[model samples]
Target chain A: DTAVSQTPKYLVTQMGNDKSIKCEQNLGHDTMYWYKQDSKKFLKIMFSYNNKELIINETVPNRFSPKSPDKAHLNLHINSLELGDSAVYFCASSQDVWGVSSYNSPLHFGNGTRLTVT
Target chain B: SQQGEEDPQALSIQEGENATMNCSYKTSINNLQWYRQNSGRGLVHLILIRSNEREKHSGRLRVTLDTSKKSSSLLITASRAADTASYFCATDHLYGNKLVFGAGTILRVKS
Candidate 1:
């Protein structure tokens, strides 16, 4: 099984439409994160969840929300999507709180969901 | 803001040759890591070198971190076509758990 798997590998929707991307990790990690990669390949952090608790939230649009139901899953929902929202979203996980497991914690990332808002 | 900036946005090499890519960061970091992402695939961790460490090696990969210079480099020796992919450098903020990535370097290895 994939260590980290995300659904809807390719998403295409019109502006004003709402969409959601689902992510799950079987690595039994305590920390999960959502990152957005633009066309230029600039990867930016959107949100991070440590053990189902919100730990990091970047300056993203309010229309975007992250929900972590359990330690193993983190999902991202976007409302009133705009053209700028078109980017590849990646799901990732680490063994634990990064600083706590500093040396050995390298992220495991999902293949990524390519979302497009026309 | 993107914490690290990768030089030579793209690289091309032939099999058996060595490929080197460098990354520079703006803030102090606890550790620096290298990752590879193949076309249409997820990123895979390559190696991690702690701030206190200078050099680390794994198989065909070698990573060096110079905290003083706030720079790191990844060297892939005896490169194979299969090693072709986008390589990125990621660093953790010295004080927090936040990990930031750089604009990746696309590596093309020809056989």
Candidate 2:
């Protein structure tokens, strides 16, 4: 079974349109994250949720909103998508390990959602 | 801003050769991890080296961490065509819960 899964593997829409990408995890992890990979292949963290609570919010624009309905689900919705929004969005989950030795927790990622804004 | 930056954005090697990629971070870290992402697949964790540990090995993969230099390296021995993928280095900061990833190194192993 896939540990982390994201829906809408491919998305192509016109600029100014709205879109949503859904992500779900079954690894029983308490922490989930959203990462965006640009054309340059620079992977950057966009947001993170721990047990349905928003934990980390990067400098992403307000047009990108992340909603976590539960501990296992985190969805990303983009309003008024722009041409610069064309990129692959990845969803990942990991155990909520904090403090010392927190880096040992390996992240499980989804295949990713490829979004294209024409 | 990205905390980690990988050297040699792209690399090409023949089958049976070894490939090495290096990463340098700006801040102190609890651990540094190496991940592999196949063409259209998600990133898979390959190895993790703690700040206190200098070297770690898993199968054909070897990882080394230098906290004093804030850098890490991932080496794959006897690489295969199937090993062609993008390798990324992620750092877990001492003050944050997120993993800051590098730009990635694209490795092409020609069989």
Candidate 3:
């Protein structure tokens, strides 16, 4: 079973279009996060949800929104996608907020969703 | 904006050699973690060292953290071709639930 999984590993859409990426975690984690990896391979945190509550919201554009239906699922919706949004979107989960578990408390990431805006 | 920055954007080494990667970050962190990504695949967590701990090891991977210097290093002994991948260091700040990642280091192990 996958610890964290995302749907539509690859997505291609025209500009001004809307898209959504779904994520689920089976590891029974309390905190889930969304990250964006740019062409430079720099990973940045976009949003974090703890038990369905928004905890961390970075400087990402308002066009991107994260919705957590439950502790096990977190979905990202982008409105009027732009060319700059073409990057790999990753979903990750951690057992606790501070990662107090040490070595075994690392985040579990899903295979990223590669989004392309034409 | 507590981002970890990894040095040597890319590295190349022959098989059976040792590979070492370094990461430095700004601000205090609760823990530092290292991850490996195989091409387009998802990142796999390699190791994590807490602020209270100085060193840790798993298999062929060794991680050392220097909280005073806000730096950490990952060393892989007896590197093999299969170990070719992108390595990233992430830091969890003391106040947040997010992990800020660094610009990864792409390691290439030639046979």
Chain A vs native chain A, TM-score per candidate: 0.96, 0.95, 0.94
**Which CAPRI category fits model 2?**
medium
Worst 10 residues of 2 chain B by lDDT: B1-10
Model 1 quality (TM-score): 0.96
Candidate 1 C-alpha lDDT tens digits along A27-92: 899999999999998888899999899988989999999999999999999999999999999999
Per-prediction count of colliding residue pairs?
A: 0, 0, 0
Candidate 1 lDDT tens digits, B1-111: 537999889999999999999999988888888999999888999998888999999998999998888999999999999999999999887776688889999999999
Candidate 3, residues B26-50, lDDT tens digits: the string is 9998888999999999899998888
User: What tens-digit string does per-residue lDDT give for candidate 2 at A1-118?
Assistant: 8899999999999999999999999999988999999988888989989889888899999999999999999999999999999999999998864453445498999999999999
RMSD versus native structure for model 3: 1.9
Q: Relative to the true structure, how large is the alpha-carbon lDDT of every model?
A: 0.91, 0.92, 0.92
Candidate 3 chain B: 10-residue stretch with minimal lDDT: B91-100
Model 3 stretches with alpha carbons more than 4 Å out:
A98-104
Worst 10-residue lDDT window for candidate 2 chain A reads A95-104
Reference contacts preserved by each model = 0.78, 0.78, 0.74
Per-residue lDDT of candidate 2, residues B17-103 (tens digit):
999999999988888999999987889999988889999999999999999988999999999999999999999888876788999
Instruction: In angstroms, give how far residue A103 of model 1 lies from its true place.
Output: 4.5
Question: Of the candidates shown, which would achieve the greatest DockQ relative to the real structure?
Answer: 1
Tell me the interface RMSD of model 2, in angstroms: 1.7
Cα miss at A105, model 3 (Å)? Answer: 3.3
